[model samples]
Target: MRVVIIGAGLVGTSIAANLAADNDVIVVEDDPDRADQLQFDLDILSILGDGTSLATLQEAEVDDADMFIACTGDDRTNLVACGTAKTLGDPFTIARVKSAEYLRTWQRKHGAFGADHLVCSDLLTAENIVRVTGLPAAIDLDPFADGLVHMAEFEITADSPVASQTVAEADRFKSLTFAGLFRDGSVLIPGGETRIEAGDRAVVIGSPASVRGFSNDLNPSTTPDKADDIVIAGGSEIGYHTARLLEERESKSRLIERDETRARELAEELSGTVVMHQDATDVDFLSREHVDEADIVIATMPSDERNLLVAVLAKRLGVDRVIAVVNNDEYVTLFEEIGIDVAVNPRGVTAEEITRFSFESVAENLSVLENDQAEVLELELDSDSSMVGYTIRELDSELSGQFVVGALTRGGTLITPRGDTTLEAGDHVIIFVETSFADEIIARA
Candidate 1:
């Protein structure tokens, strides 16, 4: 695939890095230094010019692009670039915008910017926070197959039931499979004898009910005493989106904003939410409002430093979890080291989604787990597959260490593989493998 990306900032550069491994990528940046740095770091063609200009788009050869992405951190620039690219190439176009209103306008008017996809990093980041709110122990969680299937990651605690047990013995759930385990900085396709140890991150695939049970077992503290209360600092975009999503969960949520006008706007926009016009970092205001009782506190101030301080204060006020939306990637580790529960990078979140959509797959879906240590692929078997007529045992032998078949779907039914189960062509197969071996399975299945 030939991808032309119009930005060299964090999100665009990250997307380029992920795609350049298997695709021909061309990046255009007005800043010469960033473009040259990307060229030195990755095998990609770089154009040093303003991406919104027709000359720059022509110089980047938009006509040869299979996909054109505009993510220059400016909505006007991104929309103009996508419009220019679409006029020239008619390729699949994606524009990253900051405002939800612009995205709606694009969708309502047959793509107002000629962009096939509109990505709002703030909304994406907020949605990510909402997905994991009730999942305390989950390192990550993603759903597929119309919510029938789920891929989740859990960290093994020493006292957990699955911690000292082998893969075969960790059978708390009837409809779940341990897909892959990450330990000692290495990815492992666990077998029957692979013993799960403390600090190991285990990835699993299973039905929603089964995965939910396993998630609680992995982290017992997740079970809520009553309805969870949410306290959000700053009426930022992420704060508004998070509160809006938590409403569906029926949680009691509150938003604190220093600006009176924004507070009024948020109060009118969000129902069943308490909007407080005050400084969230102020101890007196937080104490007076009983912020300590919140189950989760999300810090979404404009600056990373302010968010970090808010998170620290929330923790000090007895909040169980503090999720910080950070702009600077370098501050992520620092936030974690200082005891923030979760540090989210809007760029990383958006980049992952864009990279996931950029793929051409024969499978139903592909989800990479644990920072690309492993990947879960949902594919269908065909007559050309090597394991078409083989039993589970034989198929396992054929796959060897490359991958593990996690589940099989025949017709509309799900099958947990046994040694004697025979796999036939046209059956749906879910396999989990080390990320390094994903392409091999993609080729065969």
Candidate 2:
């Protein structure tokens, strides 16, 4: 595949790096320094010019590109760049925007901005935040097969019940599959006898109930049913959306905003959320509200520094879980290191959302894990697929890539994968495998 990306910012650079390993990737950036740096770093063609310019699109050979992505920080620039790219070629155009208003408009009118798909960072981040709220101890979670299957990554703390358990012992859930483990800085494909140690991040895929059950097993005390007190700091778009989503789930939440006007606006818009007009970073205000007793605290302030401050405060106040929205990719590790349970990066979410579209028709849905070390893919099997007639164990032995069939859905019914289970045409198979073999496995499926 040939991909042409506009704006070499964090999202663009991530997309380019992800695709450069398996596809022909060309990046366009207005900053000469960034362009040169990316060209040298990724060994991909980087053109220094304005992405919204027709001349710049031509220089990047947009006419020959299979996919065109506009993911700059500025929303208008990204939209305009996608529109401009459409004039040159009919490449599958994707635009990343922060505003939900633009996404609504595009949804009302297909191809409104010449973009085949639109990824809203704020909304995506909010959805991510809400998804984890339902499963305690999950650092990341995504649904597949129309929510029939769930892939979740949980950090195994020293006190976690499953920290010292073997894969076979932890595989108590009937529908759950232990996909992989992240130890230190590397990815490990686990077996039945694999020992799960402290600090290892375990990845699992299964039904929603099974995943929720697994979460309870990991930390029996902090189950979702007992996680009632949810507090969100800051009334930014991400915060508002997160509260709104939690409300949709019939979960009443509290939102704290420093600005009186924004708090009023949010209060009026969200019926189920209690909006508090107070500084989230103020220790006195937090103590007054008994935030220490809260089950979860999410920091979604506009700036990374503010979010960090609020997250640190929440941790110090004895909050059970702290989730912070880090806009800068570089601050993700920093936030996590400071005891923040989860650091949600908007650009990282947007990049993952857009990169999945690059898979075209091969994968119905995709989730990148551990910074692209592995991926979970949902694929609809074709009649002529090489894997159609083989059982799970047979495919495992025949396939070149190391992968685990997590779950399958046939005719809207969920099926837990087993060694003797044979695959058939039209079944939606969700598999977790190393990133390098994703394309090959998809091709065979």
Candidate 3:
């Protein structure tokens, strides 16, 4: 497919690099230096021009492109680029918008504009943080339909009640499907007699209500209380954004910063949260602040070494959860081995989001499932689509190993569809597919 990507920043270049291996990619950038850098880095076609200008887009031959993605850091520029692309081409357009207000108002006023999809980086990042931190016991979660349903990954600790129970005997997860179990780094598609042992990671899928119910059953005495006392060890953009998210959730958080002015500015912006002007690595200052009492400690300082030190200190100080934001992927396994509850690499997360968005079909948004083996894709049925008039059973038999119809959204209602259920035009089908076969499945559908 021919794809045109606007902006040559980190996000745009990352997305272009990921897609270039499989598609014809052209990156547009107004900055000559950045464009040259991206071209050199990724070996992709580069167009030096402003994305918001129609002439630049036309010069880039957007009309011949299969997809046009506006991913400039500036939200206004991205929106305008998307709008311009819609007017000039038949390509599926996507825009990256960071502000919540713009996303809320964008489609309501213009009805999808020329863009086929919208990516909200702030919301995505916030959601990713919440998924990892909100429930420390769960390793990951895949939210569907904006969080109404979820597929969650939980590690079986030695304390878990179902540690030694068989699938049938593990009454804890009654309504949820024990999708698969990972033990010794291999997946076991469990059967009724399959037994779960300690240290195994279980993948379960169900609605939020059912999944939470199952979690409660597994740990009956566990509290549903949200984290209140949070200690953030940086005031960078990502750190500030994370703190803002926590504050919005009514969580009490404090930012510890070495820079006095930046700390003061953050404190001003976040009136409810406390801001401390101190080095987060200072043991005396941390002790004075009672950092040990914090429910969670997040280290987002720019220096990876400092963040790692702070995380280790927080863990030693008895903080229930410690999360460090590190730039190096190589350090992720090392940090996890040392008991950091979570290590987030913003670049990796951002890259994953971009890759997921890049594969989105015009009729559906492609989301990566948390298990890392599959994807949850939503496909809108068109009148002439092959499966539109077919029953679920027929469709299942016709499709290959690539996909499985997980659920159907019809007339705004979600249904765990059965083989007898028939699909109709305009119905949205949620299919779980292996990434390797996603394109083939989509093409056939």
User: lDDT tens digits, residues 252-303, model 2?
Assistant: 6899999999999998999889999999999999999999999999999999
The lDDT for every candidate, in the order shown, is 0.82, 0.91, 0.75
Per residue, candidate 3 scores C-alpha lDDT tens digits across 355-408 of 776665443555553324555566777887887889988876776663556566
**Best by the lDDT measure:** 2
TM-scores for every candidate against the unseen true structure: 0.91, 0.96, 0.73
Q: Tell me, by TM-score, which candidate is best.
A: 2
Q: Which stretches of candidate 2 lie over 4 Å from their true place?
A: none
Better of 1 and 2 by lDDT: 2
- C-alpha positional error of residue 227 in candidate 3 after TM-score superposition, expressed in Å: 2.0
lDDT, candidate 2, residue 30? 93
Give the per-residue Cα lDDT of candidate 2 at 324.
Answer: 94
Instruction: Tell me the deviation in Å of residue 109 in model 2.
Output: 1.4
Q: Which ten residues in a row have the lowest lDDT in candidate 2?
A: 220-229
